[model samples]
Target: MVTGLKPEKMAYYKQLHAHAWPGVLKKIKECNIRNYSIYIQKIEGKYFLFSYFEYVGSDFKGDMAKMAADTTTRRWWKETDPTQIPLPEAAAHKQQWQIMDEVFHTE
Candidate 1:
């Protein structure tokens, strides 16, 4: 998924992720998401965030619901959401992160 970062808040965002709360990390794992990673890049003076993770569960919606219901995750989002600028696509879809199509991948 992809989203934009508020330039002024980039440092704080990085700091938060650098020492993510243990409960938040535990909740993510409990949701069956693995190999999660986030990358940032600056393009045309805009900072964009890209996140990738492997979902190894059969019930995607259920896992997501579980994650969302976690208090720690909600708290985490509260802190990070303000630091993001959702792209048009995401806004249109009422989502913070816009899903992207995989053009190429190799194992």
Candidate 2:
């Protein structure tokens, strides 16, 4: 998934991530997401964020719903959501991140 990062909020975003809340982290693991990572890039003076995560659960939709129902996760989003700019596709879905299509993969 991918999203645009606000230029001025970059530091705040990095700061929040540097000291990620314990409960939020725990909830992420509880959702069966592993080896998760986010990378940033500067493109034509704009910043974009790319996220990669491995979901190990059978019911992805159920897991995501559980995550959304988590208070800690909601609190975490309150801080991080403002730092992101939703692409049109994402905005249309009222979401901060847009799904990406995978063209190639190698193990």
Which residue pairs show backbone clashes in model 1? none
lDDT of each: 0.96, 0.96
Off by over 4 Å in 2: none
lDDT of 1 by residue, 1-107 (tens): 99999999999999999999999999989999999999999999999999999999999999999998998999999999999999999999888999999999999
Tens-place lDDT per residue, model 2, 35-100, is 999999999999999999999999999999999999999999999999999999999999999999
What lDDT, from 0 to 1, does candidate 1 have? 0.96
User: Each candidate's TM vs. the true structure?
Assistant: 0.97, 0.98
Q: Model 2 reaches what TM-score against the true structure?
A: 0.98
Q: CA shift at 14, candidate 2, in angstroms?
A: 0.4
